[model samples]
Target: MESMMSFASDLKSVSPLTSGCALIGGVVVLLFIKKVAISAYKTFLRPAIDFTKLGKWAVVTGATDGIGKAYAFELAKRGVNVVIISRTESKLEAVKKEIDDKKYGVEVKYVVCDYGKFDTKARDMIAKELEGLEIGVLINNVGASYRYPRYFHELPKEEIQHLLTMNVDSTVWMTEMVLKGMVERKKGAIVNLSSAAARYTQPLLAEYGACKSFIEKFSCSLNAEYSGKGITCQCQAPFFVATKLAKMRKSWSVPTPEEYCAQGIKWIGYPDDIVSPFWIHATAGWVLLTIPQALTTAHFTQVLGGLRKRGIAKDANGGVSPQKTKKN
Candidate 1:
């Protein structure tokens, strides 16, 4: 009976200890779960793109029209002075005037230079114009694809060369020019305009897509390298934007340039792998990564190519009809 009593006492004494251990375990598990939940919320539920923190001057190439123009307007709205670059002096003047009249408390400057051909004189001219100004943001937005719908081989060599110069070479040179200053200052942001076609292999825009892919990869890698130095770089790969360029295409999803640019600029300060409205599409590549690559590529090509052919694409002048291309 004494032994029995002793055993009961021992069990009773250990019961509290066991209970305490269980409680501690439960609390530890709960804390771990809470941490995981927070991480997940920040990773998935939060907005992927954000640029509300930027408050410096921004330079946008091809800023007179389409997404570029929208970027300029959005940046100005965010209290950033703008340096607009493009070939058309009249268009640049008009855009500058509008921005000035809007009284956004931001300065707007214009640089009229063609990117189709690399001219040392033109580069020097642009450098001189930007010599004294401090540019906090550099947007490599100027690009070109084949205007008329044609097979890769069907396009003229000159046209292809021009496209390469504008889309790839010019972007590289401009980035080099600005990045030097950015690296020296240890502060800057660069946003390059890539395309959804960069990921998918298409029949018509083979070179154009390839060039964009280069931009996307280059910007991402560069971002990784410079992020430690207070510099951020992003390559945006949006689907068809309503622009004069999109009008020449037969079909595209065709978001307004304003909508695209708004989202893009918003993403400049946001943390994410890439910034693209196309991600919201149910059938987009990012959503369907588990599917076969060949099938995804085919679908993208057909849908986007069809849109280009239909002339339903958007442009800088807004959503005008196909016949009204020259009017803008």
Candidate 2:
């Protein structure tokens, strides 16, 4: 009778612990399921907003070669006229010609104002060029990053200036210029290009990542402030797309600009203020969020450190360095 009583008491004590663990596990599973379902719905089920209904024209910055160019083409295909801006007038002209040749039934124009300058003069010129137009969408896609990962101290004065002005200043100024018009019209969409660097800690690419983070936050706040007025502001955070800036080959994770923009276009004007539109990138982003920040930061430190070593070695050997990421 004594042994039986002791066993019963132990069983009773263990039951609560077991039940508690089970409840915790059940909650975790439920949360995971909810996240998966939401992701699936956004990626496959949500209908894409027809951006043309917002206005007749979309302005895309850095629209010569990479994701910006792809966005310009995509908007044109959707029956919206495009205005492409870039530092290189020649490249901009070429892109305009290519779009025109496609006969997408939308006018294409080019602006040769360098966001690197990011000055009042440049802004005035752009303002003059865009006067008397119903500008609906603004793709704040112009940004700069280091050619390869390097310590902040070693970054040149010019490079630092470019990073701040091109990435941060340009987005702020461009939005300021067009925001009033959109507010008056009471309908517009703005897509600001951020990067995976912003979402996670980046060691060697510190300034670049910080600039992108600023963009993400700025975009979200803009969305909050303007959505009630019929304007939607979004930050599109991409991981890696094969482009001159990224210097990576296309793959499942590193998509071509076309592949990225194809999915990315759907998210614009949607309720989400910040999104990694590509499904794989979105999944990776979620995983990063689940992991410890220390782990991610250390991983970036090691990887970028290795890259810095190789870049320095190539320079010493008189080999061609990776091209500087002038625009993205």
Candidate 3:
């Protein structure tokens, strides 16, 4: 019995030592992971554009209302000449007139083009319009979600095509076109507006979220590729920005348009860190690190679906609901 007690005590002592080593090892691993995450955040999340380093002109697409118009106004306030591109020339003209009336000492120009229905001619036209202009900043802010919330098969074929064209094709084409001049000069800032929907599992907005996911991933990869050079490519993904589009989504928490624009410009002009004001919503990077990409993608699809349903049902009146207006 005495020998048995001695062996039991020895086993207990050995078990504690083993547990202690394991605890220490776990802590070290966590610290290493934290270090890696911080390094990545600094490397990719940082903004590349320095407004003070900006040249003569800036181009803003979809610069008629909401977030795009706000970006134009902010740039104008900084005395940078702006070229506004949108489908509605009248709206562009109105914006120009307002800027001129403000006497902000910035020139405003407009290009009437629908990015959703892009063609070779439209691309050439934009290229011609941009010729000889030193464009220091390019804001790819034109994107659209479906008019009605539905599953993939339930959505109209035309609407799907339109969304894909506007959200993915036009954005990629515009970046590619503008990048020619920027790469030649080796100095330019490209700001692509992405979305938090990219991270969440949203079933109803599967395509929209997927497109945003593409933008986020593409921007990060592009930044890695071009950071060695002078050009900086930054993607700004905000949550529930208080734009005309968000206004239609009754359940969304709309951050003020002015605030969104300010944050976006700050990121575009001087991205040395993540530009998102609502960093709490940065689940994409976290999930990508913690879980498998496929799993995270699946989760985001489901989350987005719920959001889409809420967005559609909450504001079915076609007018800005009281809840949305109040939130804005």
C-alpha lDDT score of every prediction, in listed order = 0.76, 0.92, 0.76
Error of 1 at 51 (Å): 7.1
Model 3 ranges off by over 4 Å: 1-52, 248-253, 269-275, 279-328
Model 1, 210-259: lDDT tens digits are: 88988988888988888888788888887777789766332345667886
Q: What value of lDDT does candidate 1 attain over all alpha carbons?
A: 0.76
Q: Which 10 residues in a row give candidate 2 its minimum summed lDDT?
A: 319-328
List where candidate 2 sits over 4 angstroms from the true fold. Answer: 1-21, 317-328
Q: Candidate 1 vs candidate 2: which has greater lDDT? A: 2
* Span of 10 residues, lowest total lDDT, candidate 3: 272-281
lDDT of 2 at 209: 98
TM-score of every candidate: 0.74, 0.91, 0.75
Kindly provide the TM-score of model 1 when superposed on the true structure, using C-alpha atoms.
0.74
